[model samples]
Structure formats: structure tokens, C-alpha cells
Target: MDNQVEKKKKTNPFLTYFKDLGTAIAKGDVSVKLSMLFMGAGYTFHKQVIKGILVTLIEIAFIIMCIFYAAPNLAKFGTLGTVQFEQVLDPLTLQTTVNDYDNSFTILLNSIIALFLIVCFILFWISNMKSVYRLQVLDNEPESLTKKHINTFREDVRSLFSEKFHLTLLSLPALGVILMNIIPIFVLIAIAFTNYDQAHMPPNALFTWVGVSNFKSLFANSLTVTFGYAFRKILGWTLLWAVLATLTTFIFGILLAMLINSKTTKLPKMWRTLFIVAIAVPQFVTLLLVRYFFGDTGIVNSICSNIGVTEFLKSVGLVSQHLNYIPFLSSEHWAKFMIVMINIWVGVPYQMLIATGVLMNIPSDQIESAKIDGATNFQAFIHITMPYILFIQGPSLITDFVKNINNFNVIYLLTNNAFITPDQKLANSNAKEVDLLVTWLFRLTNDYYNYKMASVIGIIVFVICAVFTILSFTRMISGDREGDYQ
Candidate 1:
């Protein structure tokens, strides 16, 4: 049985598909066999001229797409473009003209699009062939002998509005995904295999496939450019930040909500409104204000100095001896600490609101039972409230963790120009002390124009995010744990 299973696994789907096609043609009537070459043959033979004409037109369109669109771009796909982009004297026209240059970027993009079209056409062709074979079978039936009884044009149109409305609804969205999401992803992957950096930029220069050289550079370390070193540091901090940011907000937010809901707390509504106001104000504006307040010469620094906090930090070796002001956003450890604190400040309010709704629905019976069993509020919360919330909010918690991994705003806004790396290796790799992977990708593409490496890093970031998201979601959905807690 295991041998049989192995044989089944080894069986190629493509081979089986073609084998079925060949058998259909061998056994089919003349029209079915001819449909292999002429898409309309079987339909026209059955007197469905309009349907046959549509199929024939589609076949002609495929041919035109291949000849006009796919061929020209694919022919240049290998080298991406031989001629440099420039104007020169035309030999035939005897006038200055632009050279027939291939843009590496455009050729690369168009070739991918053409390839996508061909793949889609191939699937359609296979389905078309199967359809024609089915027509052949129907033609053999006595009831279908007089004429083809395919759906009428009106029926087809009406079905699209009624029974098949989902197709109508999703067609435009599917097209948008292909154009805006899928094709650009393929283009990014394709460019990762080539030399598409500032030094080899298109229009002025041509880039060709370098074949994993960028990937090698990204992983391999050198004296001049320590990519591997920077990757390790940034990745470490990214994970640390993600974990801290996610957990701090989550745990603290629950506590805050509980405190607000407590009977002993005074003016709970007013306190809640103040926290809500913090969230209501724009997040970037808050971050920018925080950034200015924490600047070296800002008012906060003056307050810290007047309050003797700077001297206390100097005694503890946090503030530099030469500097009178606290380098809250300038020093590496200090900046990282401040970013986490500020992120907690920004994120906790939102978390508290979410937790508020969840805490209101904490299964009153469970809490009452914990109280009856002589459990204190802390014990009851530990055993009941937290578990109930976790059961209800597990998926959201997983998403929050994943979101924090790519959390660009807090890291970027807090650290961009505020913190500069003292590490030579990080600076060599065009990285700073507090750069997250997403922010690093931005700097690489937007500032440095090191797109090749950026693409590689982009891919890495995607992989990391995807892995965490998938694993967390998979574990969350794997079993009936929700039954135990909720």
C-alpha cells in the first residue's frame, strides 16, 4: 500500500492531463478532434454559430496576444535590453532618433505580465478543450442531435445577474488584484535576481540578471559592508520590540480597563474620556509632539535638568558626562527604551478600549464562582477574566503580535533623524540603531536607492511576517481550546 501511495505521488498531474486530452481526441468525432486546432469546430458543427464565433474570436485574440504582446517582450526577457537608451543618427531615416532600447524594468515587468497572460490562457485552453469534448458527447445523444442546446444568450446574461452574480461582483476585484497586487509582487521577485541598483539604473543604463548575487551580499559579511551584522542587530530588536509592544499594551490595557471598571475608582467615566481623548487625537501628531518634547534642547530636557534627573542619569552612566542634557532619543539603549514607552503610551489606549468591550462580557457566572471559592480579585482575574478574554480575543492577540513585527510608524517616527547609529557595521549597511525591517526597507529604497538589497530585505520581512502570522493563526485555529475558556 505504501508502494502504491508512492507511485500515486510520483504520478505527474501534467502528464495525466495530456494523456486524457490525447485519449479524448483519439476517441472523438471529427468535430471534437478538429476542436483541438480550431476552438469553434465542435460548436459550429453542432449549429451553435454565435457561440462558435465567440470561441473563434477568443482563439484569434490569444494568437494576437502571443504574436504581438508575449513574443516581443519575452524575446528580450533574457537580456532585459541590449541597447542603451539614447538618441543617435538613424541610418535609414537619416535623422537623429531614439535607439530601440529595451528598458530593463519595463521588459522585466511586461515579460512577467505576458507570462501571466499565457498561463491564464493555457488554463482556459484546457477547459475549452474539455468543454468541446463534452459537446461531442452531448452531440452523440439523440435529444441533442437536431442542434446544440447550450444556454441562450439571454439565459447566460440573466444567469450572470441572478445565479452567477458572485462572478459579476468579484470580476473587477480579481482584475485589480492581478494588476495591482499580484503582478507587482512578481516584478519585485524578478528584480531580486537582477542588478537593479542606483549604479545600474534604467533609462541611462541597463541591468541584467546577476543570479542570487544580491541574496549572497545580503547574507555574507565584509569589512566595508556588514549586512549580516546589521541584519542580526535589527532582527533582534525587531523581535524584542514586537514582543514587548504587543504584550505591554495587551497586559497593561486589561489592567487599566479593570481599574476603570472598579467600584472603588472615582470619576471612572471622566478618566475613560481622557484616555479616549488621547486616542482621538491623531497618532502621527502625538508622535511628532513626543519627538519634539524629547529632543536634546526641548522643554522636557530642560525640566529633567531643573529637576536634577539628568545628574541622576549621569551618576548611573545613562547620560554622557560631557553632555548636560539627557540623550533620550540620541543614545541607543535610551532611544529604544523611550520608543517602547511611547509605543505603550500610544497603543495602550486603543488596547484599553478593546479590552473594555471584552471585559464587559467576562461571563459573570465564572467571576461569581471564583469569588464564592474564596478567590481574591487578583486570583479571580488571573483564573477567570484573563482566560475568558484570551478565549474571545485570541485571534486578535495573534494579529497584534504580527502587526507589531511590521509596526513602521512608532519606530520610524520616533527614531528617524532622532537616533543615529554609533556602530560602524550598521552604518556600513545603511542602517541605524533603531531601524525596524520595514523602516530599513524604506530607507534602502527611498533614501539610498539600493533597491536590489531592499528587495531582498523586503522578501525577508515578508517571509518573517508570513511565518509568524501563519504559525500564530494555525495554532489559534488548530483545536477546541475556545470551548475550555469562553
Candidate 2:
């Protein structure tokens, strides 16, 4: 028996759980088998009348829900609807009447809701099965033990406040997350598989499930060739912007923090305060102010024009003399460049503060050792400070990269009025030269009323962010080089 126990300990945990489950199933009597077909049979056999009735009520409710909501919608989920609204003449009254139209939006919304309900029902059914199996196993125990251990509804309620208090605390938050985040994500993903665009607007025209047709439109179709081109351009720019914004801010922020922390620097607090003021202002306000200042007729350009700076640039063959304005936001290359530069300004102060705190924690011994070895300041920084900061901030850098990919405000606000010129517009799409996938999605939904395309772009953006995040973390974990510093 001791040898068997020791051998069992060496077996896989999942294998053990299945083995125990199989044993319980084999030991189940007719009541347990009946419960599989009739949800509450085992509980009724165990004389838990209220529990049995409650379980049976849930099954009944699920049946009614399926019949009323889920079945009808699921049937139409394959083809959203076929009917379109049309005006018909009422012969007797000699008046025009609107015929009943199938609403595609209602169908899509209800189908998503029904799918959610079905999933919930399936989960509940699994729980019901598990409960029956658990009760059956308890019944097979010794009678005295079963009598002492068996829980009534009242006892279960008492256990929630006592032994299961953690579950009680977590339940509301878990439910909130499922309803708010998970359900919405599922709906977004489902929308991508349909044709719910402007042309298929509800109550006038019907939209249907098109499987991978939206994805195909994005990648292969000649009619949407411009969208493919726009996607490639935006994706490339998004990645480049994220990388540049993350690295440039990190490097410059660390340098600024180091400068302020140096003993020779006087009035460090004053210098830090000056930088903190930039961060203290709301980001939107700053971006808006910056945008205005850089506008053609705004203060910066006004001052430059007054000072003949624009004329000097034209004289030096930098810009055409025919143009009076610098075209900061109007020119695509200039706009992209200025967006990065402005992002650095807005982002650096926060990074500096973070770097300052991290820099303070670095052990003095390592720097002192490097100094004693006659290493130059640059060498010491490269070998010790860089590694230490990178090790500590690696995960944060990944998050920053992801954040920059979706940094809609910086790109959107700065060039909102200027970037979209007639020449830059995609042939059949809402995308422009300066638009990231995130901003493009916004334009598609809000400007073009192309929800299907927006949802597809949203899914693609999520995939890009998720893939990059996962790959970065995987590389960081697999390398495991952070331990070298320790």
C-alpha cells in the first residue's frame, strides 16, 4: 500500500484527476445516470429537494431561452436576413404603405446576445453535471461521515462567508470582467465575420455572414486593393512609430534623469520641476496647444514669418519660395517626423521621473568598482547602467511599445485638420497617409459608417499588439539574462 501511494505521487496530476473521475463514474448508480439526462435527478435521490428543484428550474429556463431567443437567431446567423423594405400601394385606400423589412442590425445584436446566453447555459450544464457527480460520490461514503459532511443550502451560504470568502469577494469583479470585457471582445470578433457595413444598413437592406470574406477583401480583392496598400503603409508606420517613440523617450529620459542626479548640477529640484510642469498639464491640452502653435497662421509660424525665417529657408533651397507656410502638418514626411518629436516632448518627463526613481536604487558598489578599475564614464554606463536599466525596464518597455501603437491622440490631434488632403486619400477607403490602424478604425466607423471594415481593422490591431507583446515577453523570459546583473 505504501509503495502504491509513493508510485501514485509520481503520476501526472491531470491523469490522476481523470482517473479519480472515472472511478467516481464507475461507482455511480442509476440516480447519477439519470441526472446526466435529467439535470437534478441525483440531487432528488439524495433528498436535497430544494437544490434539485433549483437545478431543474435552471434547465427549464435554458430550454425556454433556447426556444425563444437562441434558436431563431442562430438559424438566421448564417444569412442575417433576406427581406428589404419596399413601398407598396394599398389598392383599396390608394395610399402607399411601407412593407416589413428584416433588420440586419437587430439580427446581429440578438444573435450575439443569444450566443452569449448559450455559452452561459453550456457552462451551467457542466456545473450541474459536476454537482451531481460530487453528490453521488458523497452518498457512496460511510453513512455517519456523509451525514456529518453533507451541506444543505443554508450550510453552503454559511460556507461562502466563512471558508469561501475569497470566492465571495472575487465573484462580482469576475462577473463584471466577463460582461464588460470578454463579451464585447467576442462581439467584435463576430462582427468581423459578417457584412454589416453602410451598404447593408439595417431596416433598408440586409447583411449576412460572409465567413472570411472581410479578411479576403482586406488581403486579396482588387476592388479593395487600395485598402491593402493602406493597411501595409499604416501597419509599417505604426510599428516604426512605436519603436522610435519607445526607444527615443527611454534613452533621452534616462540621460536627462542622470544629468539632474549628478552632484555638479545645481538646483536639481528646479530643473526637475520645469520638466514636471509639462507632465502636469493635461496631455490633450498640450497636444492641442502644440498643434495650434505649429499651424500655418499660428504663433510659431507667425513669429517665423515676422523674423523672415520662412524666407531664409526658401532662399537656402530648403522649401519652395512659392509656399509661404512651412507645411509642418500638411506634408506627410514632415508630419510624421514632427509627431515623433512632439511625442518625445510629451512622453519624456514621465519617463525621466520613472528613470530617476530606478536610478536611485542602483547599488553604489558596482559604479565604485568600475571607477576604481579606471573605466571611462561611457564604458561604465554601457557595461553597468545600461544593462541594469534594461533589465529592470524590459517589461515596461514592451508595454510602452504597445501603448505607442495605439497612441491615437498624438497622431490624430496634431494632424487632425491638416493630414487628410485630397491627393493622399485612398481610392475607396477612409485611410490617409498619417493614419495608424487605430485612427483608421476610428475614421472607418465614425466617418465612413463602415462598421464591418472597422471591426476587421480592430481585430488586426489587437492581433498585432497581442503578437508583439507575447513575442517580447517570450524573448525576455527565454533569454533570462537579467540574473547576470545579480
CA lDDT, every model vs. true structure: 0.87, 0.83
Candidate 1 has a TM-score of 0.89
Clashing pairs in model 1, backbone N/Cα/C closer than 3 A: none
Q: Best candidate, lDDT-wise?
A: 1
**In candidate 1, how many Å is residue 243 off?**
0.9
Candidate 1 lDDT for residue 147 = 63
lDDT of 2 at 399: 86
Cα lDDT over the full model 2: 0.83
Pick the TM-score winner: 1
Q: Please, what are the lDDT tens digits per residue for candidate 1 over residues 1-486?
A: 999977875787787778767777787788878887888888788756677779889989989989998899899999998989898897898999777777888889889999999998887777777777776777676774476566655776789999999999999999999999899888888888999988988888899999998888887789976998888889899899999999999999998998999989899889999999997988888898899999999899999999999999999987879999998899898899999999999998888999999988778898898799899988988888888898888888878988998898898888888888888889988999799888998999999888888888888887888887897778676865767866
Query: Which residue runs does candidate 1 get wrong by more than 4 Å?
Result: 1-27, 87-97, 144-149, 265-270, 475-486
